[model samples]
Target: MRRALGVVALGVLVTGCVGPRPAAPVATAIVAPPAWRTALGPGSPVRAEWWNAFGDPVLTRLVAEALANNPDLGIAAGRVDEARAAERLARAQLSPTVSVGVPTTDSRALNAFGTASTNLTATPSITASYDPDLFGRLRNASAAARAQLLASEGARDVVRLAIASSVASGYITLRALDARLAVARDTLAARGDALRIARRRAETGYTSNLELHQAEGEYRATEQLIPQAQLAITRQEDALSLLLGATPRAIGRGAALTALVLPPIPDGLPADLLRRRPDLFQAEQTLVAADRSLDSARAALLPNIALTGSAGVILTTALANPVGIFSLGGSVLSPLFDGGRLRANVDLTVARRDQAAFSYRRSALTAFREVDDSLAGVQRSGEQAVAIRGQRDAYAAALRNASNRYRAGYSSYLDQLDTQRGLLTAELALVQANADRLTSYVALYQAMGGGWTEADVAAVRR
Candidate 1:
């Protein structure tokens, strides 16, 4: 026993000197910019339920339904559960395991005097074993699993934010299509009246057949727009239904395209994006998991210590009394030789950690670009909508003037047709511009993480 103890002490001392070295700390590749390229004015902080900021109850309700039923969210949740289980498994390795076992035997055997004898024997034992984690291997593994759990949770949030944004943007587009259809129908009605007036003038010799034909052709052109708009609306509704995780069907509307309130610009700094965006948070956590895993892999190069003990009683029918038995022992396994498997694992983990670092950098850069792009979209689209509205008003006035001049025979019917076409074009363009402006707000909200915070992930971990 003294020799065994001396050997163990010597081995431990020798292995400790050659244990795995700590890896160099990885630094983030990209730094956050001081400010956004497109400067935004002061605005409210992002809301947890950012979709509700649009002040449309229907849009809010749809987003709620989608969040509750989206299959992608279900998958993400399953991954979180899996990560939690993995964390538990890793943690279990740090603790001792106890088990009970029983063995029984019945047999007939010849005794020392050559007489045949029947006997039964039974041994029941309680055994325990543990890995002392002398090298911090199990702890690093548990930490890696914990980080992965947080990453999975962040991924779930990313899916949720995306779903909300998609629903809001789709709803806005549907309303825009509705507004365009309304415009087409209204223009078609006006064209019908003009065609009637032209027929009357042609029959009474007040206008020629050329004017009558032009009115009929313009009326047909406006009429075709109605069906085209209807087709587009149907497709948009179907697309929204898919987002809602329902069968293709009509979507409820609470506000017109022009009436839907524009959500406030979500306020966030570039640095804040690291914590505000779930994707970025997920990426960072993934990097953490990889780093911890690398630590575990490096620890694998060191010795593993295990302690085991068992206590039991053996009973035999031939014996006069039961025999007591007990054992306690420990082992140290140091990797003296392997075809480079342990070293290769360390290298593999290093590569994975580096990949995670670069991926996090890419996600951060993407988030910055998205925020700037959405800001530009919101500002530029708003400007375009304003200009288009002014143009629509001018076209409306010109159409009225053109119609009156044609009625008074001061201009040809073609002049009125030209003004009507311009007015219709401007009205359609205005609807699109409004939708673009609203959807840009949606994009900005999504880019700003839709009010997600690191605390949300912390709460889940707790």
Candidate 2:
């Protein structure tokens, strides 16, 4: 029960617990503007487990392997655990503190009674203190700690997302090199056949020696591309191995470039987009921390109220006498002034909070831009792939016709070689198209805030 005495002997009575105020506008702005930037497909169901969409069991295994063993991710996870421990420590500050102590003393005393005596006393005491949370300092500190914890967990999820993306990008690059190499080898073989035919015709005076030499030149050039492609493939393999937290070693190749399954990207709702991103969430948490720290600093200006109490037992015994004792006390503190220190601290906290708020806003804008860029890239690449496919098919048919005409002695062999070169270029373009599509898939997933969820952040709180 509680009663308040007002001016002129007016009085009021109140009952029940007083609670926290309605949260501030800053707290409400944790996520502002429903659509961070136009959600991809409103109501589209994003797969909770995104990596599984690739459907390559080996890729899934490799991603899992890296997540478990990669040192970078391990370090990130450890930081999350550290933040959680700090949060618990901060929370403990909200409770009363009690300490137990014991002291003993002995003294030699001489009195006018004509006898000298030694007196010994043992004092065992327990002191308990509570700040009473009159100003909520401990509570504010705890809020900062909790906010820090969320940010740390967000960092961990960011690392996890990067690892998965690196693996996928490496896989795509390696396979694209593979396709290019194969095309180069096929071109070399065709050039070899043409060169031999040219040599025979030149020896019989049916084709000029200059034509034979040109065919030989083209064949060797195609041969040169093979080594270059192989070198690139090796370098890419080394990079992927490092991402997998391994030394340079042959990696298990999964699906072929053409067979790689692109995951379905769901454009979640605008509100969902605002909430799904880890960096955005992290920024918001940091802002909350700053806000609480500001409150803590502001509270410092108020008079500090402490309720301290000590209860103890004391014993003294002589040859014929004994004494038992007990005591209790409390304390209160008030700050007169501090040469503007309190105000300065409050100002500093406010500045930090402003910085945090600005960072959060910028992060949200960047996230929206990334999603837009990824979507545009996917749209253009898909259309370009369609157009390129038609071009490739037409060039292939032309090359076939030219080869048949030359073999029947109705057209020059050079015509067949030129058309084959065109066909080769077209085939490589298809490989490029496949790679572009796969990259788009990866980008889409990454833009969706590294697949972070509220539950993941909550887990780190443990």
Q: Whose TM-score is greatest here?
A: 1
- Candidate 2 has a TM-score of 0.81
Q: Name the best candidate (by lDDT).
A: 1
Name the lDDT of candidate 1.
0.79
Worst 10 residues of 2 by lDDT: 1-10
TM-score of 1: 0.85
Local distance difference test, each candidate: 0.79, 0.73
What digit string (tens of lDDT, one per residue) describes model 2 on residues 252-370?
Answer: 66688878786654433233443556667778889999999888888877777777777776666653443445555556666776798888999999999999999988887777666
- Candidate 1 — which residues are off by over 4 angstroms? 1-47, 111-115, 266-270, 452-462
Candidate 2 versus truth, CA RMSD in Å, comes to 17.1
List model 1 lDDT by residue over 377-396, tens digit each.
88899999999999999999
